[model samples]
Target: MHTHGTETPVNAPSAEIPMTAHKTQAPTTDRSAELFEQAREVLAGGVSRNTLLRAPHPIYAERASGCRIVDVDGVERIDFANNMAALIHGHSHPAVTAAVTAQLEHGTAYTMATRAEIDYALQLRRRAPGFEKMRFMNSGTEAVMAAMKASRAYTGRHKIAKVEGTYHGGYDYAEVSQAPAPHNWGPAERPASVPLAKGTPESVLQEVVVLPYNDPEAAVAVLNEHRGEIACVVLDLMPHRLGLIPAKDAYVVALRDWTREDGALLVLDEVITFRTEVGGMQTRYGVSPDLTAMGKVIGGGLPVGALAGRAEVMEVFSAGAGGPRLPQSGTFSANPLTITAGAAAMKLYDAEAVARMNRLGTLARARIEEAIAVAGAPASVTGAGSMFRIHMKAEAPTDYRSSYPSAEEKALLSHFVDGLYDHGVMAIHTGAGALSTPMDEAVIDQLADAVLASLRKL
Candidate 1:
């Protein structure tokens, strides 16, 4: 087993590759560049989301099958990112495609409820018993927004407490402190709620109580300090943006205890980590939250999100409820197509499949750690289940402050990721990867080899 350290590892003679010698040169993205140029004429910044912007340009995906995605250039690569860890079953799974096709035969959307929606909801409840009642939305951002609104209605409080450096969604309140720089990030014990976007109003920032992650005592103290004002404490068990660091069990326990004591709701944001287990990451921590926001894998590669929780708390969304009812509606909420695809995908992600994928992830992590040790690189892998992210540091980061990479480290990581792509492996520029149902031991080994080659190149 590889040991972690704070200082950079001493490079072995064989690993002493010059940084400039192996620096990744920009790829020939002729088609993608042309498309981007055309898109810029109409689309802002030539992309819909900032995340889609790559070094030269984003690769236009032509088609995907199993664990492979083919770009417009006709280059096929193993998909390790899997659409930001959303495609647990991988691209174009027969079950999901067939289900969606069948649903498409019937009308795509309807004002009335559909059988597929009810069926999918039932399946979700079975997997996550904490979801006594739930509502679907178009995306994770919407789900988180709904969760916060429900918490406010139930507790009659406007303020929300969230962990610093964790990403809940794009919603103004949830996005606070997602990427606080060292200068702006206050003390580790009590983090300041820094706005992620420029136009964010001071009022929105003030409503968020930022707490340090992994430090149970500090988080608990912050929660207690804002006891009466906070309606909910939103957190992701394994936040992707925070180097995929799993929340400490003690920290989670503290959150549960403090929220209960303070009459504040605990909301688990499992948008990316829901695939960690059949019962979700909450089951792994053995802590239940009042509400849970879910997305990614549950959507079956479709745009979907869900807010679920205790029946009493969720009753705020009910129409026949006596008190104030929190109205929730969306034209595409729980549409039949997404419902069918999601249900089919969920059915395939049985305990056996989940275990298989997680086992592959473990093997991949072990191999990557071995590569890091062999290359004597200042890097380590952090994550659980089928999700993993490589950090440009010797030690696994405990919190967001420690996780922040220096300019050199960031450049090196970007180059390394580009190398991986060139070697026929697709990973997020930030060095995150996710396993799919189609991945086996051999595929895991291949990915490990790709990581090794990429590290050596860097």
Candidate 2:
């Protein structure tokens, strides 16, 4: 196997997260605040992503290597967030950097296709049997939107069904019922299709059917109500927003059977869950989806998304046989830089690498559970493979509604996240984290230790 030669030490002394009593005090962020002030004048909301927003000001990253990130404030923290689970090998993997730098000498984007695109596609298709044919996009949202369109084109249906509170992306139909509250989220059997963005067209809402997560019977019953009108059922095997619990095998099989019977497509959004296994989380289900939307770690920390699945379904994007039903093309689609970096990163994440990372995930989750018990905190952990989430509830939540945080729980979680930040650990604000290939048991222990300290303080 090839190696990322002479890589920077991931376990350097600087990577150690301080567990000092000073954790209660806020770190100095004068420089970050200054940058935010300047950013406010130009960048809306003082940041490019709403996810980057913090209470005072978002900390500005100076540089990152391996599992550690240094901020403009001269503070170094362990980066468990990993760019929202997009950095499988962690920031600036030597191989990815070297490959991308080499690609830069050749060129960047081009109107013509490169061998890099074909090579990367081949690599991905080999990894996941379900990815028979694929087309690249710029982000997960675009891939999902394209997949939904392909489903409609192939099935000749008008509506799409998705699990409630499962975040696919920013597309209009995709975002429906992503975060409906108790009052708005109607009956459990058939969830109401609530709009995420303000003034999302009623027509878009009408075309989306929301199904309850995990409960296979209820979900299938809802799909049955829709009958042949549904084009696809969008799913995230383990939705992070829904508390990072893997979907029950029964639920997946139910969707697979339902879609097969209804002549609708099963679109698995593995953009996040793809890291869970060499062939993605779907491989464990003993079934295959008609379409799969992939992104995140596949980009090698850059921007990329891909729609891959049965060639029959993906043929909707083809233009050769006849005028394509869904013409898909982007200026930056399959650009050389992303393709080269992704290929480098993925090549390094072999089956052994995946197993090691997942073992670290299991260790991290176990340690966090031990910490919860030691602190006597009413918290539970749920996750599979290389990711985990800490819930404030006494038991791990079974579904979105069950996991939905109450006002007190939400406030506590916010404070807990701030506490984790103060303790030199950066996790997704939801108390969730995805392990990177660069991490080991030592790093997992430090992360769990931070969780313990934060929970004790609370």
lDDT of each: 0.85, 0.87
lDDT of 1 by residue, 159-206 (tens): 999999888889999989999998998888989889999999999999
lDDT of 2 by residue, 1-458 (tens): 11112323332223433322323355654799999999999998898899888878888998887788878767777889999999998877777888999999999999999988999999999988888999988899999999999999998998999999999999999999999999999998888999999999999999999998889998888898889899999999999998898988899999999999999999999999999889898887766999999999899888999999999999898886678999878999999999998889888888888877887788788889988999899999999998999999998899999999999999888888887887889999899998887776667777877898999889
Cα lDDT for residue 32, model 1? 81
Give the top-scoring candidate (lDDT): 2
> Can you tell me which runs of candidate 1 are displaced by over 4 Å?
1-29, 321-324
Error of 2 at 353 (Å): 0.4
Q: Estimate each model's TM-score.
A: 0.93, 0.94
